[model samples]
Target: MNKHGLFQGGVAVVQPIDRGMTKMLDEQDDLYTVLLEGKLAGKKVQEHEIVESINETIRPYEDYQAYLDLAKNDAIQFIFSNTTEAGIAFDPQDTLTARPQNSYPGKLTALLYERFKLGKKGFQIIPCELINHNGNTLKEIVLKYAKLWDLGQNFVDWINTDNDFYATLVDRIVPGYPKDRATDLERAWGYHDKLIVKAEPFLIFVIEGNKKLEKLLPLKDAGLNVVVTDDMQPYRNRKVSLLNGPHTTMSPIARLAGIDTVGKVMQDKDFYKFINDEMYQEIIPTVALPKKELVAYAEGVKERFENPYVNHELSSIALNSISKFKARLLPTFKRYVATNHKLPQRITLALASYLKIYGGRADFEPQDTPEVLAAFKTLVQNDDYVTAALADAKLWGEDLTQYTGLVTLVKQDLQSLDQGGARQAVQQINQKGD
Candidate 1:
């Protein structure tokens, strides 16, 4: 809205209380700089001083009650939020009388209820959280809060009838704050910008909605890669399987091989082929999207991973390996087994790497839930730790040992990893074609 003057309406940004940030925004007249880097920098304006004093329309609000007041008084048409994954949850302790509820859903419920009192039309809610069915999940929590608060059936009916919750998939690499070159950047821009953000050239915003919703928000008109569709499952699956699956599968193996960053992994021939084969052979085959589109996205993922400007650390990607494995790779693993009626060798090797890292066989410390870490400690003591770990339903949400030949394959790979290490194991697998 700020860049192209698409929406002339007032835009208020509500944030959790941050005194300094709010003060700065207020002082600067709601202006912030976005420094586009990488391939897309010079194609458009290199530095965007967005929302620069257009009637001072965009202002930052930290006070929850004040936000509610703005919602009550102003004709708020849309609400966009990126409150993180944990933001959309129900808080049992939240009440209607609380100044501001703790959870994002609770806060939204209060705002919706206030609107319900005034008989206003529901706002178009589009959440940018990186979760599956984020809009639906948020709406579910909001309804749960309404029930807990004992809000009447009429309010619930209004919520169901009026509100529009849009599930969205946002893909971008915003490596915020160029701290290393901040002084030079400030000197070049001839101004001090405390909230400048650095981002990559690529961006795709997929919203699960119809053409009517697409017309309402002309993000596509703004020359962005925004796809509004009735079904976003294919796009979602493509992102999870191709983009995230590679990260989860390669992180532990690369880290175990003493690789620190994704660019470094891509630089190594063995590691690059290992990841490329995993995606094309194992992961891409299981995704629901068209093969051409999936391959294109996978190629783009490779480019993004190889971006020298973005130092994506393997350890950062390795956080919560157990759950990341389940969410990112396990679906593709099961699908490959069901379809091929055999093991996906690369995915199996990835699983073994995960087990080795988490099962105390590697030098790395695995970060996961305390229960998961504790269970691994005991499972590793067993001679058949791979079998024991696979059989534990609590860890994988299912007894993975039940899959045909999965345990045996993973065990053999784990043994190979234990004896020869990750890089050697990767080379051996690459040399032995599937």
Candidate 2:
């Protein structure tokens, strides 16, 4: 087995210490743990068999106590998680009394208590769950567990003084298991493992909190985008809005353009420029980051979309469309309209694209079949259909009913889409933006 992630497949023979320190580190979906150390060092390993086939003379992690001892006594640490928005939640029934504890946080608190058993203060924990303020949320849960179990003031002080919890945002298109090329991929790694973290060549980690981590974890030392700041809001906004906002709004449109994946869409001159222009002019101006950083971010986004190894399907990114719009795009739309005194044309086209796509499939499934999508789903292909779609307040998260002109604009774009297609609608919106 080529223990060093080095390969002769035309890629440079560089043995990445952390393989970009990502572990694909995606959270949406994955095959298994990507080992960065031990004998398997550079090779991607089967997540399930990773602990079972141990060549080293070390015991496998047994429970929360194992984590506690490792982090405290042996000075090892890990951020264990299921990596879903639904997974990083507080469990009402989970308690210190329960063996292994039902909730991830409760189990984690027990471990923290064990690690601080010696009464010293120094551990930095960064959670990667997709929840809002993931690290803070976990800390809140840990405290709740402490109170629930009557763990005493000493433990609470230890928690406050001795450890640091960081909020971090991880970005990468880690689509798991290249089933189509699993055999060949496995052959390249010299293994029969199927649990691999398949991802794009792109990676970005924004760690906002605790400079103490710089002393140990070398994510920043490696020149990764690991920012240690007192505020995570700007980073969150930049990623959710500028980096993802345009893509979220444009994916369905991309799919409808007869494009299968983001990589291909990036190559399509019209779609590519449409997305780039939207992010720069419409979305970027509305975000909180500086113009310079935003521009650089947009440039890199084009490369991420162009990563050849990543098969980032347009439809896959289109899931949870309603939530995505509300969380990612809706606020930006409001900001753009509020500050600029008018609606952003390209974004509205993306929204209108959603309605048109929702009423019926264009090339991708509607983001969701929620009431908003459902209402459009009912409209007949009559002249009033586009107008009818914009009246739903439930989807827009506000009474967009008042924005009649905006509605008219969206309708016009939708009409153009019906008459010409995505390219023409995009062109019309660009002209309108100008």
Candidate 3:
């Protein structure tokens, strides 16, 4: 948000709250200053400056009393947090009396309780955690802490009635502290700042809230890509289907093809063509949103994948591929099946690749549930692994074998992979589709 002119107008003060993870958080708190320097890499104007230098102080976790003072003085009206995906967890051990509770939601509960004691009005809490329903989840965890602590029904009432927690989807490729380019950037800028953030020009903050939040935040006026809506399902759907779906589906294929980074995968003509065709032809049509909006988002995703500044490793993207496929791609697969009365060719290919990557026969072991790993291991020992795997509803949400010819196609792809490796399998699959 500081990238935009939101902070310049003095509408709000950007206060930092420590939420653990010593290494990364230490860097952020150490600098307490950020130099925004990067180009909008795509077809956008290279000369345009979207981000500027902004300096802010990070209050350490030890300064809990200071936060209490701020609460008493009505110095804060909004709370913004990016505590990673795991930060909003509920720790049953957390209590109200501690200087600051360990968990993010725990700390938040303490702070809110302090404010409630002071009879202060509620604050707009926006959590930038990557998890779905971030604000709702945070609020839920906070409320759970309150109940566990027995902080009184009045405090709970104040929390439920007064506070506004906006569920937000924040998108930006902020490859922090560009160490590789730091020297060059320092030379160019004629300054030495260790706290430089290299980010893509494309940014989106989709906030799920009412008109009150829209009025409170002047991000739109500051020329930001901020959208406030009563329902964020469509935006979330677009993000999952376009951005995350590609990452999940493409990771196995890319890794099997000996590609490392996502940008490198995009550089490959065949891989790029496959991903683009998968998105536009298979994924977009299955998304419930309008075709025009989905197509535009898909185009943006393509640009993001080709970003020269971000080096997204296929290994990183391949984490928890089992659950990721379930959460990100399964719905699309089911939707495609419902609409077309047949399994999607690209999705099936991706699925085959996914199964192959985790069959305990790949070069690198895949990370997944132990139960799932064991299941896959059992399947690999079967006489016909593809048929058995496809029929196992325990892995996929439903029986994939129910779809006509899907099991055969998966078996064929797996057979081709066994015969000629990933390259040959990919080529053969694409050729069959063609």
RMSD of each: 4.7, 9.5, 5.6
Q: Candidate 1: worst 10 consecutive residues by lDDT?
A: 53-62
What's the ranking of the predictions by TM-score, best on top?
A: 1, 3, 2
Q: Give per-residue CA lDDT, model 1, range 1-434, as digits (tens).
A: 44677865666766642333556676677777776655543243244445453222322233556757755755578888886544555679888787777667887888899999987788899998767888899889888988999998999998888989999988876656667777898898788887777767778899996567766887898788999988888788888888888888889888889998788999999999999999888888788778998888898889888776666677767766777787678889899999989988887888899988887778869876555789999998989888899999977879998998988889888888888989999999899867
| lDDT values for all models | 0.79, 0.64, 0.74
Clashes of each: 0, 2, 0
The alpha-carbon deviation from the true structure for residue 47 of candidate 3, after best TM-score superposition, in angstroms, is: 7.6
Note the residue pairs that clash in candidate 2: 121-162, 122-162
Tens-digit lDDT string for candidate 2 (1-434): 11223311111111111123222322312224342211122233333223222211211123333334544544334343433443455677877765566556876787677777765555667777654588888888898888988999988888888777788787766655556666876676666654554665345677777676675566565555566777778778888787678767778677667777777877887777788788877788888778999888777767666766666676777765655666678888889888888787777878877777777747456655344455565664657765555555655546675764787887777778878998877766566555
Please report how far candidate 3 places residue 311 from its true position, in Å: 3.5
Which candidate wins on TM-score?
Answer: 1
The runs of at least 3 residues in candidate 3 whose Cα sits more than 4 Å from the true structure, single-residue gaps closed, are: 1-73, 84-103, 175-179, 191-195, 315-327, 348-421
Deviation from native of the Cα of residue 173 in model 3, angstroms: 3.4
- Quote the lDDT for 128 in model 1: 85
